[model samples]
Target: MKNNSAMTKIPKGYTTITPWIISRNTARLIDFMKKTFDGEEIARLYNEDGSVGHAEIRIGDAVVMMFDAKKEWPDTPAFLRLYVEDGDAAFRRALQEGATTMTEMTDMFFG
Candidate 1:
């Protein structure tokens, strides 16, 4: 019998380092993910206070899960840099969706 664990073939449709973001605006983020990347909501959990506890959305072959950060989890926040097909378009979309522009989208040598 062969040891399948030692096989070198890369698994098909496998993604790496899927991040689970924590944010107070989970519902807004979910909407942003949907509009920005055509994401679909998979699962969601809400608290009695109507705050989103957790949620999952599928965006462009990637799954992004998120939850509302409580006072206990002060370090949790969603900070992401997305490399998309069109930076300008994405930036504009983000701005239109109420994302404060921290840095105006500009072309850099490395990027």
Candidate 2:
């Protein structure tokens, strides 16, 4: 498919399968994603209590949705990997930006 092709079904600049995250603090998560991936905030909805009800962030042609965890809807575990052109440099920058290093970079057997 051409990069400039029109998407009839899905919206432009969005993929079919978007990842949704239900976190305790949606604002913090949105801020982190924006800072880490240079994402653009295209949509945001807040609840009466000033918590995030819903938000859509565009990052590299993909949109990720996030919602503040509610009493009925609790926080769920989510794993979103950020892929960059320079892995080594991004890893270092993520650390500097307060990302907890769970796995150190290493040569993968698949490579």
Q: Which structure among the candidates has the greatest lDDT?
A: 2
Residue-by-residue lDDT tens digits, candidate 2, 5-109: 445678767786899998888887777777777778988899999989999998887889998888787558998776677778767766776789888898777
Model 1, TM vs. native: 0.73
Off by over 4 Å in 2: 1-7, 71-73, 109-111
**Clash count per candidate:** 0, 0
Model 2, residue 109: distance off in Å is 4.5
Error of 1 at 85 (Å): 1.8
lDDT of 1: 0.77
Q: How do the residues 1-111 of candidate 1 rate in per-residue lDDT, one tens digit apiece? A: 887663455334325556798886798889988887667898899998888888988776777778877766667545776667887888788778888877777888989
Residue 105 deviation, candidate 1, in Å? 1.4
lDDT of 2 at 88: 85
Q: Give, for candidate 2, the lowest lDDT window spanning 10 residues.
A: 1-10
How large is the C-alpha RMSD of every model relative to the true structure?
Answer: 4.3, 4.4
